[model samples]
Target: MSHDVDVLALENQVCFALAVASRSVIALYRPVLDPLGLTHPQYLVMLALWQQEPRSVKDLGAALQLEPATLSPLLKRLEASGLVDRRRSAADERRLDVTLTDAGRNLRSTAESIPQTMIEQLGMPIPELQALQSALTAIIAAATRTSELTGEASDE
Candidate 1:
């Protein structure tokens, strides 16, 4: 009974810890991203674009693990910011392609420092951070598999 009670404690809950940690870590990005005129989600979109331009919305959504409905508004905002241009694919009119504009491409040079800045701010060594990322990825995969097995819908 004591074990069960202790297990039920909020502090012992993985979900609670993850939720708090996620919020806290994202908060750290605000000051850094504000100067870049990006929200965390917007920054993620730009990161993907910086890696490869002319990505289809479907591909971007998959790469970002976001649904089309969620990705659409982000893309729209980026387009409005003149950081990206969305147009129909020439090979497939039904497909929309997102390409970084010149300004967006230029912004990458400035954004390059963000990773080092974040590392310094976090005060964690690269190896530790990489391990944490690996663990988190495994957790995500396990949670996804559980959701699938149980037929539960997950936005993530």
Candidate 2:
């Protein structure tokens, strides 16, 4: 082992960097999401739904890497806001189906500019942002695969 390598330093810890960046970037979305009546987590849920509606809670939880316990409350709030509806799936009574409401569908138009706004706010180029997102997605996939092999993914 080389004495030049300081493994204990915070700067050298990828987990620490990822954790800090995640918190900071989510924080940046707070102001941007507030006007749309969404928390960052809620916005993420909406994004998923906007892409594909009438999905099961389980499906959503999987896609968002969230748990039913954490997702149920958010769904309730979105429902209360008149943006979504939760119903029993037609084929399966046990599964809860979540679908966007008319209001929710309409909100997509308003949200179209949000991405550009955030990029402009960050003063970051679109290509750079795309690259960063790709890198993060890769990291998440690698972590998930490793976790699955180790049986830690059972929590998901």
Candidate 3:
């Protein structure tokens, strides 16, 4: 407790709280999503695809905040699971497009109940959970925007 300590001390770190909370939430999701044959990262990829049916690998990586190196392996796993298909873009032979297969599309039926399961698991009221989700969504959006802006600046 030195008075000369830096202002950026661990006790005042929102990042630390965010990281701990995120890990805890993901842990809660593990048992629920496990039966669906999805890891947290894989579920995130599915969420993106569900929102937008087909997207290029580059686009998916950008949306998921992953680099191709990290994303490729995950995509491979999903492809092997028969949940997604990665094919060469006919319009651009150099590019790859990832599309959810029929099984992947059908997974939404099973997954739709996950939100309720999570609420029951957390024992939180829907309103409270919605508030938390909103706050986290905003934080993620701001962080993504910041990263994108910084990336663009660095590339110039």
Candidate 4:
């Protein structure tokens, strides 16, 4: 047996674990967000809008680490759902602004419990989850910095 055997193990791959964990966690939100007419990505967009509205598409893309092409469709879907309005900015006709509609603002109340429900379903203590979040944030920052240095910001 080689000394690098452990390093080459599938279970030891961070990307593999992260990918599976992300998919699994997102799946947990499926049933919960279905009633709200949101997919996990759409739900994330709503969360950002709930925090601050009238943001430009560029701003949302940057905040969500999403590419413009990827975010455009999600915004269109949200607009069609009556949860948001996508309009040309009055100040800048070239820019698209995303704002919550009355329905979108009202949906906030219903979404308020989703996080807690997700936590309960995961059955993890809040402190542990918080720590996990912190670690993930650090990983993201490191990856972002690496990408900046390498000129390879997230391919997607």
My TM-score estimates for the predictions, one after another, are 0.93, 0.93, 0.82, 0.96
lDDT of each: 0.93, 0.91, 0.90, 0.94
The C-alpha stretches of model 2 lying farther than 4 A from their native spots are 154-156
Q: Which has the higher TM-score value, candidate number 1 or candidate number 3?
A: 1
The TM-score measured for candidate 3 stands at 0.82
Better of 2 and 3 by TM-score: 2
Give the TM-score ranking, best first. 4, 2, 1, 3
lDDT per residue for candidate 4 within 10-101, as digits (tens), equals 89899999999999999999999999989999999999999998899999999999999899999999999999999999999999999999
Best by TM-score: 4
Off by over 4 Å in 4: 1-5
Error of 4 at 127 (Å): 0.5
Global Cα lDDT for candidate 1: 0.93
Error of 2 at 135 (Å): 1.1
Better of 2 and 4 by lDDT: 4
Where's the lowest-lDDT run of ten residues in candidate 3?
147-156
Model 2, span 1-156: residue lDDT tens: 379989989998998998898898888899889999999889989999999999999999999999889999999999999999999988999999999999999989988888888888789888999999999889888888899899896345
Distance from true location, Cα of 104 in model 1, Å = 0.8
Residue-wise C-alpha lDDT for candidate 1, range 1-156, written one tens digit per residue: 565578878998999999998998999999999998899999999999999988999999989989999999999999999999999999999999999999999999999999999999999999999999999999989988898999986674
Q: In terms of TM-score, how similar is model 2 to the real structure?
A: 0.93
